[model samples]
Structures are given as C-alpha cells and as structure tokens.
Target chain A: MKFSPLLDELIRELQVLPGIGPKSAQRMAFFLLERERPRGQRLAKVLDRAMSEIGHCQHCRTFTEQDLCEICANPKRAAVRQLCVVETPADLAALEQTHLYSGRYFVLMGHLSPLDGIGPAELGLDRLAQRLDEEQLEELILATNPTIEGEATAFYIANLARERGVKVTRIAHGVPVGGELELVDGTTLSHSLSGRRPLE
Target chain B: MKFSPLLDELIRELQVLPGIGPKSAQRMAFFLLERERPRGQRLAKVLDRAMSEIGHCQHCRTFTEQDLCEICANPKRAAVRQLCVVETPADLAALEQTHLYSGRYFVLMGHLSPLDGIGPAELGLDRLAQRLDEEQLEELILATNPTIEGEATAFYIANLARERGVKVTRIAHGVPVGGELELVDGTTLSHSLSGRRPLE
Candidate 1:
C-alpha cells in the first residue's frame, strides 16, 4: 500500500539516515505528519541551516560554522602538542566527554574500506600528513575504534607520523571500565593482560 | 561537554523527534553533518514542501494536499456508508494496509486526555458530529485503540453517533493473530474470551 506522493517522498528521504529502514521510515513519516508538524518544520529549518552553513573545519576536518572548528580555534587547545586522531566526529566527542584528553583532534570522517572504495585519500591522510608537517606536534594519538577498518586506518596513520619523526601512540585496547573480567571477550581480556601496568 | 553551536542546535532539533534522546540526537546530527550532507539537504527540502503543502482533509481530517483526502475523494469509497473512525493518520494507514475495510475514515488526530489538556474539542468531535449529520453513514466503526484514553474517546464518539440515530460499533478486542495464549496479558485474555464467537 503506497502512501500519498509527498508522504512517500518524505519517508524515502528519511531512509537516508543510518540504521533507518523502510519500516522505521514509514513510522517516522506518519509521526511527523500526524502529531509533530511544528517539530518537523523546525527540523527542516535546522537541517537547511546546518547543511548550508556548517562545513569541515580547515584545521581538523571536524564540523564547524567558521573556517576552523571550535577546538581548533581555541588557543588553549593549540598549546598542547598532542594530537588525537579519530575515525569520526562522534568518536572525538566521546573522547572529549571523558575530559582526560586536553589536546586537539583530527577526524578521519571514515576508516579505510577497500571494498567500498574508501582509501587513504578518502580518509584524508595526505591532508593529515600536511597538518603534521605544519604543526610542531610532539605526540600523535590514534583513537580509532577497535574494528578491523579502524585498526588498518590507525596503522596507516602511525606509519605516516613515524616517518615524519613524530611520536605516535595508539590508544590502549582492553576491558572497558566497570566491565567484569569474566564477562569481557577473550581478545579484549588478552589485550588487558598484555597491556597491564604496575601501580605507582 | 558542549558541541559547536550549529551541531548543538541540530542535535536539539533532532531531539524533537519521538524516541530520539540526547545520545541518539547527537548521533543523528553527526551522521547528517559528516557523510550524508546531500541527503540531509533533500530531507530538509521534502520536509518544507510537505509541511507547507499538506493540510487536514476537509472531509476526513487526514493529511492531503487537496480539499479531501484520497480515500474520501474517491468515488468508489463515497458509495460506502460505513465510516471507520481512527485516532490518528497512522491508525488509518494501518487499517488501509489490511485491504479489508473499503469505507471512509475520520481521523481524530488524538484521544481525549484531560491531563495533557487534549479534550473533545481538540479531537475535533464537533467536526465529526457535523460529518455524521451530513453523510448517510450506515455503520460508525469506532476503531480507536483499546487503551484507557482510546476507549474513553471511542465511547464519547459512540454516544454522539447513537444520539444522531447512527448504528455505532466498537472494533473487537481480542488476542492478536499468532499470539500465544499463555503469553497474552490477563486483560486481553478476558476480552478475547468475552468476545468469543462460535466457529462457522
């Protein structure tokens, strides 16, 4: 059963979002049309504004309205020579939430997926190399996810930074905080044991 | 931790959607800004078009660009005097998917909820009464949900229709198809038992 043309178009458009399928799109469409028209209008306006105004930060490639992202623009963040590289903006945000990382970030936007035609260029490795050459960075922290693509991307970036005479380090992988040893997967448990540190 | 102004505003706008919390909103905002910029722009355009063009159908109060909704505008549907009243456009869409009901529909848009300040007027009871008086409706099928609020709204409409000399009936409440009897809730089990019919 097909919906009205406009409603059908709206549903199709909604499916472009990650993880939203046809069923979810239909539900969202009905929801927008039925009860939350004003909210839908607001969403439309914000989406338009964000798309037109927000672009990749000139320094770190993170989303920003200005030429440089907020973090990149801030002088305090620039004082630190350590640069954290992440697979996406969400990853950067997650690291920022911890408030432990006082340095700047470089968002790769995506990992190297050869099957999907995503390579070093797609992940902006050349631009990153240029940034490393320009900035007097002491440490390069690879904070990509634990996935295969993330590991590959991290390895590629680590090699590039080491060749440029910069100290490169990968974020440690292990059982997460508050995670029970027995509940953690074997791979993670092994990494935790291998990377264990002595109490100061 | 605060996001960039544009990202923060986009996340807040995304939270207006039902079922989207702060975390989900942030994820959606990043997804739109990072890779799916064109899709986000298309969504914005579609939303704007839908909001501005679509309005309540003059006849059934369902969403439509025309004066009457597709179902009400159809000549074949107009021949049927059976009127199925649903609480929202989503409910009407669900019934239409079954392809069993060939009658017209009157969407209430919401149920009677005094706590939320949604009452008879908010549900457009006056317009429904007018429709009932104007049309030669044979059966007024109250297909509102079986929730407490839905039941109250259905009863109110049923009373008004009966007063206007129309045969009013409520949709049957029973165990859903393929539902296990043991797993069924007590209220649903009782309703199914009370509404039991002899096998033909």
Candidate 2:
C-alpha cells in the first residue's frame, strides 16, 4: 500500500517546500532514511536553529539572525541613500553577488498577485512606506523581476515613492547580457529598443 | 558573496541529500527561511522523528519503525517463502506497488561497487545468507536493477543460493511495458529476443 506512518509523515512534510511534488518528496524521504542518521539529525538542528533565530531584518526585511541584517547593520553602507527594492531575499542575494550596488535594499518577499490574495499588505507595503519616510532615500530602484506581477509591484511602489517626492526608477527591461536579439522575446526586444541609451 | 553563516550552513547541509546540487540546495535553504517559520520547524521535527525512530527491519533490512517491517512482520505473508532481493528500499517499494509479488523482500540497500568501497559487508550480505539458512525458501528472485553493479550483485547472490540448494531466478530484462520497440536500446532488444517465451 503506502509507506509506514513515520515515513508517510516525513514525505508529507517535505512536500510543504516549494517545487517538491509527491515524487520528489518520496525521493527526499528515502534519501534521508537511507543515508547516515547523523545527516538527518544535522538537518533537523539546522532547520530548528534557522526557524528560531532567523527573522526579518528591521531595516530592509531580508532574512537575518539579528534585528538588523549584515548589510543594514554596516555603518559604511548607511551614507548610500539609494534603496533597491526587490521581490525576495534570493533576489537580494543575487544582486549582492554582483558587488555593484553599495546602497541598502528593501525586500518585498513577494510580488503583487491580487488573484492569489497577495496584495500590498501581503507584500508589506506599509513597512516599505515607513522605511521611505524614515530614510533619506534619494533614488528608489525597483529591482523586482519583469513579469506581470513584478511589473505591477514595481508600478505600485513607484507611485508610492513619487507621491512622497522621491525619485523612483525601475530596473531596465531588455535583452539580457550576452543574449542574442533573435533569441530575445518580442516584449523584451521592444523595451530594449525604446529604452536604448546613447553611447558616450 | 556567499550567504550568512547560518544560511550558508543550511545550504551546505541540504547539499548532502541525493540529487541536491549547489543551486537546488540554495533554493531549498532560501525557501525554508522565506516561508512561514512553523513549516520549517515541522520539517525539522519530522526529520528528527523519522531519523531516530526508523531503523532497518531485522529480517528484510528495509526501513521500519518497529523491529521488523510490516511486510516481514505480517503472519499472512509468512507462508510465501519466495524472497525477492533488491538493491534499495526504493526498489522494494516499487515492486510492492505492482501488487503482483506477495512474497517477502530482502533489501541490500546498495549494490556491489568495489570501486566505491561498497562490498558484501556494506550490503549486509551475511545477514542475507543467514536468512537463506533460517527460512525454507522455494525461490530466490534477484530483483536488483539491470546496471553493471546490479548484475554483479545478482550473480553473487545466485551463486550463494545455488550452493545452498535454493532455486535462483533473475528478473527478465527486455522492452518495458508500453514501450516502443523502435526506441528500445540494442542491448535490451537483444535480451528481449533471447528471452522470448513460448505462446502456450
């Protein structure tokens, strides 16, 4: 029939993760059971510690062990008034890997999806508004993805910032770096053409 | 450049799982941290419970919460003296899903891979041999996979059973059910032709 009760429960719990379906959940459960028991124990410890200790950074809303994230807590980054707004901590981490941005970040943690009951409140727009009011932010960069939901989220945030006398800018939508024009989507190609910059 | 210490540790730990590479590990770690903390906490609890409570069935070497697995402990299945040997618990589960084999199972947990230091001791072949002696088995079915390691393991077990005066049989290797013959590999096609049965 089905797996044992404990194993069934493990598989069920594992499916709570994003992108893990029934098959993947079963594979993961078997993997945990078959491997050295210590590995599963270590995973448990890490999950417990992360759940208990990790929380939203007070300033930027990114995942952090303390009240403020490492980026927010750094004194050197405070003078950089520009704030980059992203949809998730993963996006923030991706941008951090580039080593280009010196300013702070505000993580929405999700994009706007009214159909799925995800709106301003769900995306923590109030907290974002508070951050805008408190900080001397010069230019607000909307670094959310270029999908429909991301566009809606960026537009909403742009309006919010512009109303408060802040300059809001969206990340350029165009053919990706090293991408061929023939391979790029029509919408992206159009955006790239319209937003093309003059070569200095 | 990298995730914070706790997050980094989580990514590394996730990578220990089978099929989980660096990218998947990072995705899982971020997913855990980003989701509701309770979900992660629940996964931790399940992992701990399964790891601590689940152990090998003394008789079959499959995962079980009790001393013997359900298949091994059931008195109804005791009369079925045919033992199907498999390389892993996953294989045993797959066979069980077929509902064709009422016989009991013996899980080697791994195949013979001398290059990887996996041998008889690692697969608990001594226990298998002891079971062969204790049980009045009619037939020993080698259900290990069709890979090189699986073939070697089957051959080794076949010799062990033949020496003990037990009937030994290997599962057929051919074109799978619902498979197109044109797409079937050459080796499989050859095996299918050689193993052709009479239409009685």
Candidate 3:
C-alpha cells in the first residue's frame, strides 16, 4: 500500500535527521503507523510544541526550558570557574559525560568554514566573547573537533579569550586522527584529558 | 552535567533504533532536550495514538489505520491476481517505489533464520498459506532479499506455494549481492522487473 502524503512527509523530515537514511526513515514511518493513534498524535504534538518551547539557555546556549540551562542555573556548577566551548550542544554533552568538568559550556552551533560560508559572526563568536568577559571565566576550554574546520574555530575562540587575558585550552590529542570526541571511548577521553598540553 | 535519569532513559530508547549508535543517540537526546520537552510529550502522544489506531490489515500484515489497509480495501488491487511477499513493510515500500507491481503484499516482518530463532511460524507463514488457498493467486512473487536468510525464507515460501499447486516466482537477480532492495537504484529495479525469469 502506498504511504499517505502526510506519512511520506513525516518520513522525509525524519530522513533529514543524521543517520536516518531512506530505509530507516521508511521503517520508522511504518513503526509510527503501527503505534496507537494517540501515540502518534502525542508525538506529533510534542514535536511541534518542543520546536516552539525549547530555546537556547541564555547563559551557556545549551537547550533548556528556562533562560538558563540546568548547569547554568545550578549553584554547584557556578562554583567551577571553567567554561568548555564546543561547536554544538551535543559536544558539550559529550564532555559532560566525563564528569571531569564541573564547569559551564558555550555551544557555537557551527564551526568556521569558508567554503560553506560559516564565519565567526554566523557562529555567534561575538556573543561567546561577551560571555567570556561578562562571566569572568577563568579557563576557556576549546573542545571543538580535531578537523580542519574545528581547529580553525578553536584557534579563533582561543585568540578571542587570550586577548581578554583569560586562559584558553583545547581538549587533547587522545582523540585519534580523524576522530570525533562524540565517538571516542571514555577511557581514551580521560587519557586525552590527562595528557592535554597547552596550545602553541 | 550528566543527563537526568529520565533523559538517560529516553536516550537509551532512542539508541535502540537501527544506525543510531551511542554518539548519534546522544546527539538526538541533546538536540531533543533543547527541543524535546513538549516535542517528546507529543511523540509519546502520537506513539500511543497511532499504535492504538493502526493494526495489521486483516488480509495482509501491512499497517493500516482502518481494519483493512488502503491496498486491501481497494477493489482494483484485488483484481491483479498476484501476491508479493516481502521480508518487512520496508521491503514492501521498496516494491511500491518500483510502480510495477499491481498485486497485494504480505509482509513477513522478518526473514527465516533458524539460527536466530526465526521460522515459518514466526514469519506468519501459516497466514500466507491460508491466503494462497483462499485467493485466486495467479502468481506468488518471492520478492525477498538475496541474503542467506532472505533466500532461505524465499525458498521455504516458494516450496510451500508450489505444494499448494500455485505458481511461484522469485525476484530477478537485478538486486546486487548483499544489497538491500531499499538501496537498489530505481533503474536497476525496473530492469530487474523486465528481466525476471521463471524460478526452478
């Protein structure tokens, strides 16, 4: 049987999500159909509602219901003077998994890519710089990926923080060549942290 | 900050989806967090709603909001006198994309794999056999994949159909080795249709 156009549209939207290629999208679409009507309606409603309600945390740019994310609102986290900078909220989450950094985070959303036309302004570099100054951050940890674009973004942010006399650091090389921090095993991540050297 | 236990639960659930390994699941979880609170609620609602509303078509295992799926409900489809059997609803969708098959479909939802505890009973073979006896099936197309399990399933189904004194045919070898029907290019699929030969 042919999928209804609405069903196809939903599948297409799901396909846009990373790793959800055509087949997976079709499976998910069919799975949704197999779900109870209330379940599908609830999911669709929440999808629309979350898209409308979930906004960035003003303090750290992480997703949160309130102006500040849980980390930014917590007094316990405020005690830590470190700030980990990442290209996306997902990256911040990866670092958070380590339990090594009790500090705050700044999600840049994207890296510097001249070819793709992504630049400092587009990535909210000014907002990040302002936060660095306003928060009186002790350490600005650049945890962008190790790719060329990521490295470029890291250096740019590092320079911005360095100019303000705030110490800047990058997550270490425990991440393999062409490796993404999101995929690295926990032990390797810890070793990378322990072996971190100052960015020259 | 570590995700709350509830968020962790949701992320784990999301991870169970195919191709959504740990990192991608984490990304989806965080992305949803920024955007999921209500969206998640909606998803749950939709899941419950759709599951309750949809069920297996009485004639075919394809999901349908109504008692009979669109295909089974349509009189025109019943006139085709052919039956296309697939490993799953996704495979049925691949066949639908070809726009060549006018017959109805019977989704097995899985291939035969004795090693994996999958057998005729698990794949609803009895229902298919009943349908073959009931309908004036001109052709039973074994449109399953070319994988070991898929082949086994096809052979098993074909033998059953032949024993019932019904004609049986397998999809052409136009599908690449180890390639899923969903991944086959449209041109190759159409070519495969025209090149189909009688199965021994």
TM-score of chain B of each: 0.92, 0.91, 0.77
Say which docking band candidate 1 falls in: medium
Q: What is the TM-score of chain A alone in each candidate?
A: 0.91, 0.90, 0.78
Better of 1 and 3 by lDDT: 1
Whole-model lDDT values for every prediction: 0.89, 0.88, 0.74
Q: How high is the lDDT of residue B129 in model 1?
A: 96
Query: Model 1: residues >4 Å from true position, as ranges?
Result: none
Docking class of 2: medium
Arranged by lDDT, best first: 1, 2, 3
Q: What is the lDDT of residue A13 in candidate 3?
A: 59
lDDT of each residue in A9-78, candidate 2, tens digit only:
8888888777888889888888877765799889889988988887788888887777888898888888
Write candidate 3's Cα lDDT for A1-200 as tens digits.
25643455555556545556767877776765643344445445444445455667787776655677778888988878888888876677778777788888888877899887888887888888888778877898889988879988898888899899999887676888899999999977987889987899
The candidates' DockQ values read 0.65, 0.66, 0.18
lDDT of 2 by residue, B119-171 (tens): 99999999999989999999999999999899999999999999999999999
Those runs of model 3 whose alpha carbons end farther than 4 Å from true positions after fitting are: A4-10, A30-53, A66-70, A73-77, A80-85, A94-103, A108-200, B1-10, B29-50, B111-126, B144-165, B169-200
Q: Write out fnat for all predictions, comma-separated.
A: 0.64, 0.65, 0.20
Top model number, DockQ: 2
Using DockQ as the measure, what is the rank order of every candidate, best first?
A: 2, 1, 3
Residue B72's lDDT in candidate 3: 78
Q: Estimate each model's TM-score.
A: 0.91, 0.91, 0.63
